[model samples]
Target: MHRLQPLANGLRTDHPVPGIPFVDDSHIPIDDPAAIEAVICREGGASMGRWERMNEAQGAWLAYTADPLRPELAWAVRHHPEHGRTVLLLLTKDAPLWHSSWRGPKLLFRQGGYWWDGTTWYRPDQAWDATCKHFSLRPVPDATTITAADILDENARTDGGRLLDVYRFDPEAKPPDSWNEHLAMWASQRAADARPLSQCVVRLSAPELPADQLIGVPKMPNIGDIVAPTLRTYIARIQRELPAGDG
Candidate 1:
């Protein structure tokens, strides 16, 4: 059984208080604007009834993952456009998070930057904030659009390592995911080749937003009532491996 752990600073986000309707504090502040935009866009705007419903479903699952008692081995946030809703997929080790090492175990698909504006799924650069009460639109790329090269350069400036090395990409490749795939494949190859595994950082494009906005809203849900007991145990095992500190 997976064991559950308390949410660390890195994973905690602001959320509404339960059983409260239309309270002022219900609208929690997200520290990182870009991150908030990612979450909001992923949620398809707060005004959408579908988004609210999806949030309710996913929020319950997250609460389960956050439980200190009940735990999950791996949980996925599944988006279903047909129903205009999202669901959580809880799996045991029989189904690992990802077959590949480079990818995270779970997937949350929504608007992102890589595609043209208005398309589902966006790359981080494509996400933007518009002046709206509880919603925003994806911005079209313009002269000011942050390019992959620009992202690489910024990382190089901030960190001593070259972005190319960090991201493991070829400059000539179009549609950067090809490079991302190459890096992933190479890691898999190395693992198979019996080479000592070395830590390699990968540079990813992310949206620009405030700290609170990036971190999400905070709230605690009753997970014990929702998820299976064995899954809860699995989460606890993983939580024990995490670094101990404030985060």
Candidate 2:
């Protein structure tokens, strides 16, 4: 139906669904209730629903528009009260986009906020007037609709497992004792391989002497004479070894 689905169980279809002009000014209804129902039925029997959260005084409106940049793309919308201004939600109605191959009727809670009007593609304003005009709209019903803030909070709560999968975190890892410890552990896991202080050790080896020659021990250099003595000793050792080979 070009008309909206009856409001039931927290969802009301968008009425006077936005229609887009095609090849010869003939428009295709963008939010066809039957097509929406077919999609819902195909995808595990989910509902394409809207829930009103604010009255007309709060300046929220649920809208729909075909994307100008990608004609195949369509959007469901809800205006939100942010601070003293208004914001728009490119809504997904009943399920997240990820659920139905990124085509579910997910409602816009607070994330996935992209602004649009039928004529223009992407915008960032609350822009109720511009949007309504662009889509040939009337006053949408006064009811609670989904907002970006609601979805954002839901995403934060529900995305923990998905994030863990993205970074390949060990699911069985124990909770860190403190926040600092947690940070340190995370850094250690991600940083490059380094030979640790505990693994480093110094080894000393004596110079090999021929069995026939008497071993002449050189005096150790004091800290003050370390550089000079070290150079002298190296030179003397090389000279001595050369002469012995000549013999």
TM-score for each of the candidates: 0.19, 0.17
lDDT of 1 at 103: 25
Summarize candidate 2's per-residue lDDT along 130-212 as a digit string, tens digits. Answer: 65553232322222222222222222432121112212222123222232222222223322443221221111111222224
Among these predictions, the greatest lDDT belongs to 2
Deviation of model 2 at 45, angstroms: 33
Q: Can you write out model 1's per-residue Cα lDDT over 1-247, one digit (the tens) per residue?
A: 1122212111111111111111111122222223222332214443101111123233221111211111222222222222121122122232132112102111222111122221232233223346543223344343122222332322233222112221222212221222333233223323242322221211122444222332111111122232322332443355322111100
Worst 10 residues of 1 by lDDT: 16-25
Give residue 213's error in model 1 in angstroms: 22
- Error in Å for residue 111 of model 2: 12
Which candidate gets the maximum TM-score versus the true structure?
1
The local distance difference test score of each candidate is: 0.22, 0.23
